[model samples]
Target: MRLAIYEIREGDEPHRLAHRLLGDFRRWTELVELNRLDPPYIANDPAPYRARGLRVLGPGDRLLYPYAGAVEPVGEEDAEAETYGRDLLLQRGELALMGGTVAMVRGLENLRGALERRLRTRLGELPAHPDTYGHLLHQYVGRAGGEAELRYILLEAERVIRQDPRVAGVRLEGELLDGEHVRVLAYVEPIPPGSPFPVEVVL
Candidate 1:
């Protein structure tokens, strides 16, 4: 397989990118191996590898991939039947791999991913629209706060989630995972076209 350059996009994930450009998400290993990336979140080892933390590839990041193929074809059911939205499937910051390829999600799950990501981002983190792109929940992290602060976090999370046109309504709840972390559960009611769903985001 010949090598090709893949300029990562905002939503690009290794497995998903592999599937889109290499005909199989499983080929993400080829990306790591070719790029000589060390202990990416997908590494299968113990201790030190786990301690190194995940490598986040943002927009403009370039990766070398082999077998640059056309984007994977949509499944017959999805193409001929309902047009469920398509997106990369991720779990705990890593791509969910199947048979060496990345897994894919559709429809409501796509919305869930969007909600999770929005809540995890800190307000003003995006340079293009520094004033409007992220959430304030990150500010409360690793600091002392009481009921009022928690309530504010919830409100902020709800506001951020509702920004997605897909979300019709949202109910938020939170728990102190520990002194340094918080987990927010958002039960989102999608627009009339889809069913309601819950998304968990830890910060």
Candidate 2:
């Protein structure tokens, strides 16, 4: 995947950088998570002031943003292929073995597996993937209680699921479970107008 590297100039914060680059101030969290930056974004201060939640940009501080590229046209043979995407099948977070070899998942199952993985991954945790590829649902783990928070969780879950190209759209509802875990119930509308399937993701 191609990415845009943004240099942090003097007096730049997450919101300002996001607005200047992504054109949306609301996407500041995406900036912060993409750069794996914590609060009090001090330059080189070992002891940053913790009372205020302000960000300070340092020299040579830069951010990375995923850039969209032109999609390659699919051939007739590829279009007729059965699977949306393919990968080694994972059952219960472990490789599913078949005849002493790793089994593979294809078609709708592969798509489901991919969606689940994307939803469960914490943002900035996977170095191989674009920093914005995963969900930020973990942030609400211990703080979700009120109706507004629940609604935000559901919306964020839907946003993350919809990022998958295989998923045309998604309807999500958030349920708070014991141990401060949030469960996202999703009804995924796949590309090519297939029947919507139910998926559950716990974060």
Candidate 3:
């Protein structure tokens, strides 16, 4: 298995929030120790890792950090198909969120066409923008609430991804403190044979 560790350093306020939510000031400290990170891998300092491009985390940034367990592709065909499907979903989701109706519809149509061409499978119909809007609204509601709610939402998202057959496992790497606040770094792993993703709760 190939492992890639992505770290996000919490800003001062976020760090405090984490402590409050987890009800343990040393929760993060414990995790850092458990991970056996070296002296330079300090949780309080985002500098060293930022210089190495591992610090992509930001305030309100929900990241999806992927860890590929198998260095070798399960098989060229499966790997290609999985990659294509995931990329298409990401692209479509982003376009749907940012583009206005006219643009979104156009983008969706384009995505459908592209997916069909690449996978020989129709992506089926696209949901109305209002429906998408409502979904997003619900998500926003969940994310905007207290730390407990935020943790629930994060866990739920992880569950959803892990349930997908294409994903082998998922890991949640972030700080969840006691005060109902969080700093997240999440990732997904795909198994050789289709299986739901597994999650490793980092901290």
Candidate 4:
């Protein structure tokens, strides 16, 4: 890993530093984690800094850049932002699949089955909790009753994921596969506060 130094300039926030040093602000999360720096970002746009605390790189602050060939990590803020964007895209694209362009591709029988397989794998891997009376065990998961049991065991997981402000809504369901395995589906959406039809006047 090569080490380099960058002098913080006026209003040079961590994300900005990532863009300047790594050519992509999205890697800011990595940068801050690497240097153990606090993020100094505030935003009206659901900033990435929420996941990490960082301070803006004001003038006179020397920041460290660590790198391995062809890999540039963000300054520890952009990843959180990108993660939100990505989560939104995943949810939007997934929901749109019920009807939309992506549906055609996602419609393939093999692909749908593939999604089922992947979902099962992901949920099955959640670490078990000792206090849960041996709950969330990877081995016992993906079985017949496991789906219902998981809803309770993973209630906190659901709550935490739903905590994302952008996450407008979420629905969970499970299906018995081949009379054996259980495939779970989580549908998420965002519904802005409003009435379908409203009238407003302005001067």
Best by TM-score: 2
Clashes of 1: 2
How close is every model to the real structure, measured as TM-score? 0.53, 0.58, 0.29, 0.26
lDDT of each: 0.62, 0.63, 0.35, 0.39
What candidate 4 gets wrong by more than 4 Å, as runs, is: 41-57, 67-203
* Tens-digit lDDT string for candidate 1 (1-203): 33344555555666887788778888888766555455542322212332233332334434555543455654544432122246788897689998899998776667678678778777666675454445777667667776666777787777677545345578889887777787889888865346677898777
- Between the candidate structures 3 and 4, which one is better when assessed by TM-score? 3
Tens digit per residue, CA lDDT, model 4, 1-203 = 44444645555666777887888999888667554444343222212332232232334334556534555675433432322222112342253344444332211222223223233333324343111111122433444565565554244223323322223355655444543344445554422221122111110
Q: Compared to the true structure, candidate 3 yields what TM-score?
A: 0.29
The alpha-carbon lDDT assigned to residue 95 of candidate 1 equals 90
Tell me, by lDDT, which candidate is best: 2
lDDT of model 1, residue 69: 44
RMSD of each: 14.1, 10.3, 19.4, 16.7
**Better-scoring candidate (lDDT), 1 or 4:** 1
Supply candidate 3's per-residue lDDT for 118.
Answer: 24
Off by over 4 Å in 2: 1-83
User: What is residue 110's positional error in candidate 3, in angstroms?
Assistant: 16
Question: Which sequence of candidate numbers ranks them by TM-score, best first?
Answer: 2, 1, 3, 4
Off by over 4 Å in 3: 1-79, 82-145, 174-184, 193-203
Please report the TM-score between candidate 4 and the true structure: 0.26
lDDT of model 2, residue 118? 78
What value does the lDDT take at residue 125 in candidate 1? Answer: 69
Model 3 Cα displacement at 71 (Å)? 23
